[model samples]
Target chain A: MVSSQSGRRSRRWKAMHDLSPRDPHAGALPYGKLNLRRNPFGELEADDWAALALPAVDLDDVARRLREPGFRVQFVGPSGSGKTTHLLALQARLPEARYARCDSGRPLAKAAILLLDEARGFPRGGGSCALGVHEKIAGCAMTVELGAVPLDRLDLIVRSRVERFRRGDGPVPEVCLSRLGALLERHGGDLRLVFAELYEDIQDAAM
Target chain B: MPRCDLTIEFDQGKRSFAPGDAIRGLIRVRVEADADCKALKLACAWRTHGKGNVDKGLVQETVLYEGTWQAGEDRVYPFSIAVPRGPATYHGHLVNVDWYLGVRADIPWAIDPKAEEEILVSWPEGERSPDLGPAFSAPAARRPINEAHAFVVAKVLLLLGLVGGGGLLWEAYRSLGGKNVSGAVQYGIMGLSLAGVSLGVAYLLARNVLAQRTLGPVRFEVPRQYARRGEQFAASLGFNPVAPADMTKAVLKLKCKEEAVSGGGTNATTHTHPLGEWVLAEEPRRDLAPGMGVSLAGRVLIPADAAATFASSDNRVIWSVEAEIRLAGKPDWKKEVRIAVLP
Candidate 1:
């Protein structure tokens, strides 16, 4: 019975067959010798951000332009250049839409497909629908401007974070796409500073 | 086909444990349809996984089974847990600590039939690795200075920081002397020279007035508050020089770090790493007189593969010991001891 889901950590947390192939707290990890099972650029939770946010737009065209209701759009960029991973992959493909970070004090979530993140607690003639601004947010009605990070979508965000931490499935670890095109030309493409500089070189080659 | 099938068994398949040890378990259930097991929980946690932002602890819990069940049902619930004494089970390189024994079935309308099993607490083989005692309370005889009553409170804070920074630079030259000082008196003489140089460097750093004008009373000794891991303790530093100092190098360090804060509370972010540094002794130059009295001692070690003093409330594993003094041009005298390492 390998079914799972508890304490809100289910973006399909797996790779455990009675764990302990010797790592009893911090031992082996060269990304588990590149068969990968951790650190494909660490620090993830919130159930792995809608399964590793690799959205270069078209989440059904921004959920069909926020489907009516004074329809606004705006998914600009800057702080990490993916705009909250295309607004959490369009709030995980519209699970009844209602996501609001708004600089984390929330409040301003009337729904009807709201999804504002860092919206500065949204004000300024209120009304919003699918926005993840960072600057210059003036009343959008469809903007979508995620510049810089475009090297085949940073190779599809490092091939979907190394295929979501693979650890079962023959032959892994081989995507040096020219060292990720030199880390997207040395971080000017901000996929969160190129995944925080490859999570500090995979935590210094797993320490 | 309504789904629900949870399983977690560990009683003699024990998976290894220790720290009060006792983690028996068994929770099997199957439900292809008819089910109403409201609150069937059983937890025992410990979490934290790389890069930061997942510090957990839920020591023990139980509630085996709850209500009804029917339709291809089979059940069993028995558990025993009690194993804590950590921040243990680490696997650092950003962070990692784990321990699990879970089971859940708050199945109402479906979607909550969890079951987990992963244990290995260790720390019980010639046991010696759980002290994490002191973290801070700064001591150098923590607040007890009476060298002629702190030299009359450091001469009333050096005459209240040079007469309140020369009476606010002579009240900004008698109120921006004869106008033409432009807009708001040129912002009132640059806000009175930045509030008279920030009130004379915040009243001359209140009490360490350049470490009592260059090392006068500092007898810091670190009498082992806790340390072990190829331990080799002992630290010292003595001083007495109410005047005349020309030194330009003196040291003694020993640090170990890991901070991790990551998100929450107005968007928190602390992230320090450091993990190693040990000088444990150093000295050079000289020229100190005034009833001279100096001392220095060594021996610090701690590296038998160090890294054990931990504390949780967002993760930390510090261990400090610093004692510096490099004067020549004044201002450089430090002290910070905080030891607690075991493991």
Candidate 2:
């Protein structure tokens, strides 16, 4: 499945290459060259999860369990640990599941499978359901703990996106990659913040 | 109840007058019971209403009659007052300047019976009061530029430059296989250099063309064109970038300012004081590829105790939305749209 997907992506890249300007440096920057329909660094919608390429993580298993009836699960992690991403991914996988923020005032009893985000703020006795939170609740049937993204994993994510714009030929600039690594360390492994800062640097460099 | 009823009527039943004209009117009083009428006063004044705070200016006042009143007495008093040669009447979004002729009968130990009639004061041809200033004057209509047409033209030029430059390089490559290897190499080198330079130039032209094509016109969609004081205002901004470019930052802001003229005649200096400001959007840099545009929504909660929108001849409190877009290798684009905030 990965091979076929890569093959299709390569073909699309070839088509874009042919339409690009002759000057190699003209369209070299990734700013105006990426897919315009979606923002890679910010929040992703339900349909965008299928195309996400990141380090190996077992979110699919959690997603599958979240679909089952009466399975009260809680995903606990620090900020920017992809907890929200996983919850959103689960929402995509389980179309029948109802999703809401902790303060949304949605009646949990009405939903066959409820996905509550920011569950730490949720009041007690709101009925059992899956929750995405920074800390585990006491009575959750299952607790899924996510750790901070390592610098190597962050590097892979950045390389994957940069490589897409380069059409798999040239290496991403060493200075740019090094700067991103430094940012990861400076931000204490806050992956989302690191990405935001990296995106700003890229935008500035392109300008 | 008042012992007498008073009414003021303008001459010739004309409710409108120009500056420097005489305001001729009659005051009529009907005495219903025996009462001590101290004085009959006629006051001419101009006042503002609707927003901010009320402002009033007395044009003229006079005592038309003074004496005791009989139970069945009726009196009509005629008076004439010269309208000031300045300060023409104005109507605006949050302010209005109106003139009135008020007649009041001072009845001792009872409610003073009073009547007021509104009168319109307008500017004569080629005679505008300097106090009215440019802010109160009606804005002239402007013709909008057709940006889409300009975009198409820029795109076409870019395509032509790319095609023409590519053809030259292809032709130069094909000639490299000919005899006289060194000569051919020399000729090819020269052709390659020329093609390289031309391609570079063409690429820059195309990039600039795309930049121009994609950059503006920014549109601000305000939820309400008019707002009450202390009410939150929201607006959505849409920026059309026909070609890809890096957007370093985008921001939305709301500001209220007081503009006034100080000093007199030739030494008059206009001053502006910022009353309040709110930052609506301050986003990190992002890439906007070709065919990509930006649509962002933002809101600002006007301070509950903030000043309302007000305008007069010499003073004004204005509310506006300022949107700024920063693009790579191009000048930042900024625009402001004015809105009304009522009290």
Candidate 3:
């Protein structure tokens, strides 16, 4: 007869061995020895981080949308197009909400609001348990179709929105194109105007 | 119609063997659904490369073995070829030993055919002959052995390409001094390095993956058959052919009214069609019933200019035409037409 402590230890051993990290659904995606640890954000300082991050767009409207459950949107662009950075900046405006990579080991039904970055690398075929959750939560995913918008327009829009948000007196619950046009000129057309007046509205409502 | 499909793998068992050592192993074969194939014969022999007088002059041996097999069945017939004696020898290099199976089908067509396999032979290191014999020496080297070093150097060029691509990406990032150009450069480098690592893993798995040899179902409808004369023959937008455009070669099925009524198999070929022609299979006669169906298959070359069109080509208009048609109802009633128009 085994002692209670020994029996508990045996159960723990069985559980750990059953779990593996190579399984994408249950394990980390095998990116295979990537040198991605370099500080990509090292060049930017902390205080300027907040100001340089949020484009001059109105955040109240965007914040409003995020509060309403089932709200979803995507920012499509090629690699280095700033989809993740833009999403992170958007997150800064929403202090209460939290984010995390959807865990691979747990059933997808067990998680909500998955953010797929390299969606092309998704596994082609897998068991039904993983598939069911993927379909159910697919709508909540915000994926950017790279190459949808030109880079010049994207920079212009990001800068203009930040300018308006800084002014703090644009259209309420709606986008104000006139103010966006002024901000576009202020930046001297050096950047692309991606979100323009609209992104700010979405952010303001969500915040 | 039931057909015989065979796969012959060249497994050069051991590095070396004595002249009389038994060359033994199972020759594997697979038959398709419901076949009335008669006896299958396995034939194997060694022959030197090239044409005429030099061919089969150094023949090792040729043997015919008989075996009876059925359809949907996989059978491995064990074989043992007695290594011949005399000055004949197999050096520790790839020597060709071609083997194929012959199956006689009950089908009326004399197509009852033979399947073949090319096996490679090599001998282990043992007694070194002071004078190299023609049998054991490498395939006659037209060029000196040193010539292969040049080919290896050419393959090394892939690395230069990788470095050049990386440098170009970095320059683009630096020129565009946006929010974080450095971050983009870092990610780009990481992605490329990861790809290299994955390729290595794929190379390791290739030895285990056997190549599959079998014909897929044939489509009866020829694409773009109604093309105006002078118009180029082209496949519809959604249908993607697996064959390369330049190597456009396809076997098309054709038929005539009497041929279709009697359930006969007939086929015909069309001269290569220029890229732009829209081809559609046409009925042999205009008076045919509306419900009648026919089949055809053939290769058409997509014009070289097709790739030069607007960035994606899908958005551009084509000005050339070439066409071919196969009507099952009329085997001999085949047509190949062409069309040209101002851009």
Q: DockQ of each model against the real complex?
A: 0.14, 0.01, 0.01
Residue-level lDDT of model 3, residues B1-343, one tens digit each, is 3455554432354313344456555556665654544454444333321001111322343333344446678766565665443222211001112111222233334345454433333333332332122323221222322323533443454455456556655655764576576666675676466446444433233211110001111232334422222234443111122221221222232210000010001211111112323333322322223223233334344432231111010011123222222222221111122122111
Q: In candidate 2 chain B, what residue range of length 10 has the lowest lDDT sum?
A: B136-145
For candidate 2 chain A, the 10 contiguous residues with the lowest summed lDDT are: A31-40
Position B10, candidate 2: lDDT: 73
lDDT of 2 by residue, B1-343 (tens): 9998898777877767776678897888889999887888887787653222345674587888888889889888999987764455543323345577788888789989998766777655434223342343321232333545544655665566456655555555565555455665655566566556655554443443344556645675666656655567887777777667788988888888866543223323455667778887776699877557787778877775565554565557678887777787875665576776544
**Per-residue lDDT of model 1, residues A1-207, tens digit only:** 223322211221232222333433222333554455667665666557777776665678767666655677777777678776677777777777777676666456566677877674344444447777767567576777878876777877777886777655544443455666777788777765677666765554444
- Which candidate leads the pack in TM-score? 1
- Prediction 1 TM-score vs. true: 0.36
Residue B88 lDDT in model 3?
25
Global CA lDDT of candidate 2, please? 0.60
lDDT of each: 0.66, 0.60, 0.32
Error of 1 at B338 (Å): 6.0
Candidate 1 per-residue C-alpha lDDT over B212-261 given as tens digits, one digit per residue, 9 for 90 to 100: 66577778787876767786987888888888888777788878888877
